[model samples]
Target: MTQQSATQGSTQAQQSTAATDAPLLDVDVRATFQEQFEALAASRGEVTALIDATDTSTFAQLEARTNQLARHFQERGAEVGDFVLISSRIGSLIMHAAIAAWKIGAVPMPVSDKLVQSELDAIVEVGSPALAVDTTDRALSVPRITDLSAADELSADPLPAVVSPQLKSPTSGGSTGRPKLIVSGAVGDPAAIAQLGRVMGVPENGVCLITAALYHNASFSDALAALTLGNTTVLMERFDPETTLVMIEKHRATWVYAVPAMMQRIWKLPDDVKFGYDLSSVETFFHVAAPCPQWLKRAWIDWLGADVIYELYGPTEGQAATALTGAEWLEHPGSVGTPKVGEVSIRDDDGNPVPVGETGEVWLRRGVGEPPSYHYLGAEAESAEDQWETVGDIGRVDEDGYLYLTDRRSDMLLVGGVNVYPAEVEAVSDMHPAVLASCCVGIPDEDLGSVPALIIETADGEVPGDFDGFLTEHLAKVKRPRHIVGTTRQLRDAAGKIRKREIKREFLEPTAQS
Candidate 1:
């Protein structure tokens, strides 16, 4: 057989093998999801699967409750195309409920469980989920999930056949004025899922930690992969550095998936507080919500004493575009490695492929083992033929084919008539031993049109005020920040993307009198 045909046959064999043993739940997408969850519970037995702030759910318990919720929604007025807005904090309840929603063929809109009333209102107003399932009363008037037993009054609609995993609508970042609903879909490609599992080293017996919110795509994939692999998952409702360290020690979580900011916070805990936990159980210390500073990554590697720290590069619309392990990362330094199991390329301004070594938009075409599975809700972000797509990132390929992400084109700063990429300045700022995390932006300046500004979030001993002098030592005067801001809390969104655009509006936008 030719190489192309051989590859095709190989994929077919894998799918055929999976079909024989893999009992997809109902038949359609909903049953497939139900089966995935049920299989995990059956295989894992009483393994502690998820922990919320106040409650814990074992695999069996989670499966039982999620099924009840799924039955409730199925009985309610939910339809395949209808959106199910799940608003809850990070917990087993929310994650399992989302799986149940998927099992019923209803599109699940995962709203951040931590959102205040106003944010929840905005999302609910835009998404308009047919059923609003919230666990907590973050908002006074929202419908909340009380109990599954009570759901018996609802109808028992027979589950639909397997529909493809498609997102009917998506939650926007609100980078612009208002967040709009985006049409999106999820990929059900087994090859891509298998490749992601391999890269994550998701063990059949390990417990995967979901520290990121369920609403975010990265977290969604993390939860799905954990269930698909029949492993236990521990969910963190909200990340508390001390709490996280304790949980790692307490639960003996085998794998952790977190954003760089959270890792920085965990590392910043006093050595006495940080070292008390037993992290030996964590084999896959993976992260991918945002660009991790080399310093932070190095700190984590040293702290974890595990060589399994991995980074995945992909967006909401793009899942598992590429991944790199800690060992490979040290060898390549800044590269996010080659495409995980797909094809990655850099496209220039004109939409043509840029020769290797030149910075351009990073684009991916679903490759041999990675089939195209995601679809956008609307034309705002288009996915075209050949299954190629870009997530607004600028990057380049090295001579060895490793991918180096420079910055997001949207986050680029124009300073003093010169282009200043915030990633560059943030990289320099992060080099400061005292600085834990930082974000840079161009503030309006009459003298230079726009000038670089820095917002620093200190680790334990670091101070934002001290960052300016430290930054001056590492960067040119022009690139130095005109102002420095500070925050003790998490600075990035759920996906670990710094809300720089939002930060600019809150601080720099008003006071940059120029």
Candidate 2:
């Protein structure tokens, strides 16, 4: 019955609408992904559809370019249901390449722009794309599109309309070294896409600024959402703390997609430097990727109005999700808020529900017998007898059903019999004036199994000799780091991940990078 309703909506949404509202309806329509751009071009040809650091493209320009590019992709063997891996520099061309893939009814999978050759091999073995786009001109396993101009001469006429089997296939934490493709199950269902757009705070005919790298699924997907919803999208070629503020004011952006790492950089800027730009133009400030530090979350709430800040927590698996506006966050400070969709519960290892407020594995159930929303390529989900599934995240719920995450089981260290999660330790240490970003990892210990260690990245590249003493006041004995170290190397990847496993291997072991 649900499938039938979606099918009906897709059929209805494809039919042309009346004038004056056609451009608006074009964005609001429910059809194949390419139809959104095609409709926008037909009715609102002159409107700016995409903007990057160097260039901007109108809807009509994008439509024609993508059409030609789509033919080029097909000439290279990309067809409906084939994968098109896009690993390119940050720019409008990246988005155009993605739109081209969608136009050809192929799944578009964006990976880290700086993917190492080793990482590329593993992903390509699993992805098996018909073609790959790398503007960096690196050697790849599949047919590669090295020059963007090569596609310009292809015919710009519309191709036969076809829907992608899946909405998109984004590599899970690709930039952070975990390269699993998360294949969404939705078949471009019009209603589902519309709801996702709204959830990301996209407003019709508004400007959406994207400050982070597009390879991150959340960042890119939201940009796609803005375009599909008939909004102007501004993509930053690279993220600069002050420039983000400048772009928002310049574009008068109504919606912005950012993660916690970007927020910290902007926050660390001197008050005068940060306050120099006009940020009153921003409306919806959406952040996700990892659990936000309490101090940082509160700081943003105080800077921007509580009503404007929003957060989401869930795995890419799509089994569960929890969202809260900053206003709601004030009521439950550490909680990620009650479920906006999908039923969430804390379960013991036996899969039985734990008492409220008891920390346990967090599980989610969309429906008892409903089909899965996503499938993984390189990883498998831990699921219970029912439809409930978990991605190894450990958390709890309050009496009011608000969720609070402790940490992921993989990242939690058994510290002398007591579990120690790094978020709390890093959160406390980040409050120091000298610290820019900090990552907490459990160092192997003979007595305690693993002992917590502090590794910080500072703006001035100076390691505070007494920083451990500063943490002494904030962290408990069990959570306190036994050793403190600092590095000039970047701590988090573009996906806003600390990558504890990688940090333990590389940072702790000096020979990794050199």
Candidate 3:
């Protein structure tokens, strides 16, 4: 957006928001994200800071509103180091709550607004947040604040600068459906965040567009990075493949954060619609949170320039990470790239370093004297002495140091004495054009001990006639799924994460009945 267009729909309280191509946070000033928000307001105050489907906020507006809301939370008993669980539909309130939490030196824990009462209870029990926003419908264990009108009555004047010890506390629950808060070990400093962003391919002070739900790690990471860099970020309330392209074109988005599922959906769009948008503005196209099918990655690389495609792989814990450009990926086809952060290694169950090219647990230890990358609230780290930890991922590194993940140890199936990786099976299932998403889980088999059962979400909710033959050609016999089920029911969440345990349970009932 041009300077004129960005300020058009901004808050009328003060319309002097300056839109510039320059970075917002001054690394030299030594400020937390909270103080940087105010600094941005002083310099880039009138610039558009956040955008949702129905509203846009300038830096000035965000600073003032967050100030008022910070006082609101402080007055309601939230304090430094406390968790402010944020759950709301995407809009001004979401950003307002997050920035407000930061202003008061509290950690903002964003969770899915669509979570049911039981799910919310489980998460709340773990974090035990001092206060919650937009979760008004429940009789929670803590105070639940909903009305923003009262906050409007509070002073918008700046609060005393306070930096949170924990940068953020995003929730994660893979397959097990057990929610846990991942508290970042980094302080709430923009300089550290900016430094990390650069290594992760985040463009500074450019138009950023996000399609995933804000609750996800990647979504909030990009959103906050956009804010820290003074970039105008456009957020979609829900993802629509066609609308994603429209927003990119309309905003002239220079950076986009997408997961493989989202990327696949966009590519599945009619070629005319997919290729119609002016995507030349996109300098970085990012995908993570799930393993991308090689075919899909190739398609995106062919469509977008190889340099524009960026893939990052790591746990949200942040201790271990690997990244690859499309060009690098072309050279190391199935590799997730060498480590750009942390000291990553592959080790056997005995904690001995695995020989290169042999699959084992992927381990990471922080840089010398560095604090832990993250600490989990609900569970202990799967770790060893000497600051080494594993997230239960099974992978191997090539002699060249490129890492290739076979699958999660918990997700791997032992089929007739063979190590069957569900990712390999699912990747093949997703290779079929009709498949939108696929999950492979192990089912009880009298002969093989356990067999792969694939549940796929397709356009017509029916398995294609040629899918069996397609699977036969792409996957080995031991890796093949014995049962293939089709469903119209949504499989993956908005963040492109699938719940394999749920998939297995649901599919198992029908087979048992038959």
Best by TM-score: 3
RMSD of each: 6.9, 7.6, 10.7
Q: Between prediction 2 and prediction 3, which has the larger TM-score?
A: 3
Which clashing pairs does model 2 show?
A: none
**Candidate 1 displacement at residue 239 in angstroms:** 0.9
**Candidate with the greatest lDDT versus the true structure:** 3
**Best to worst by TM-score, what's the order?**
3, 2, 1
lDDT of 1 by residue, 1-514 (tens): 1111112254323211111121122221123555555666666658777666767767777667766677787666776666787766645656666666766777767776666678777777766677877767566343445454666454333344344355434576555545655544343332333334555556665778888777776676566667656666777776777887777777788888788878877777778888877788888888876777777787777766537788877665643356778888888888777665456656666566555577877766554344444543323553444455667788887776688888888887777777677888887887765666777887777778888887777545346556667777888887888888776655676566777777777756766764
Show model 3 residue runs off by greater than 4 Å: 1-30, 512-514
Model 2, span 367-469: residue lDDT tens: 5455787888987766666566777788887766678888877778899999899888988888887787888888777788888887888866667877878
Q: Estimate the TM-score of every prediction.
A: 0.82, 0.91, 0.92
Off by over 4 Å in 2: 1-27, 173-178, 189-192, 509-514
Candidate 3, poorest ten consecutive residues by summed lDDT: 12-21
lDDT of 3 by residue, 371-412 (tens): 788999998877776577778888887766788878998998
What's the count of clashing pairs in each model shown?
13, 0, 2
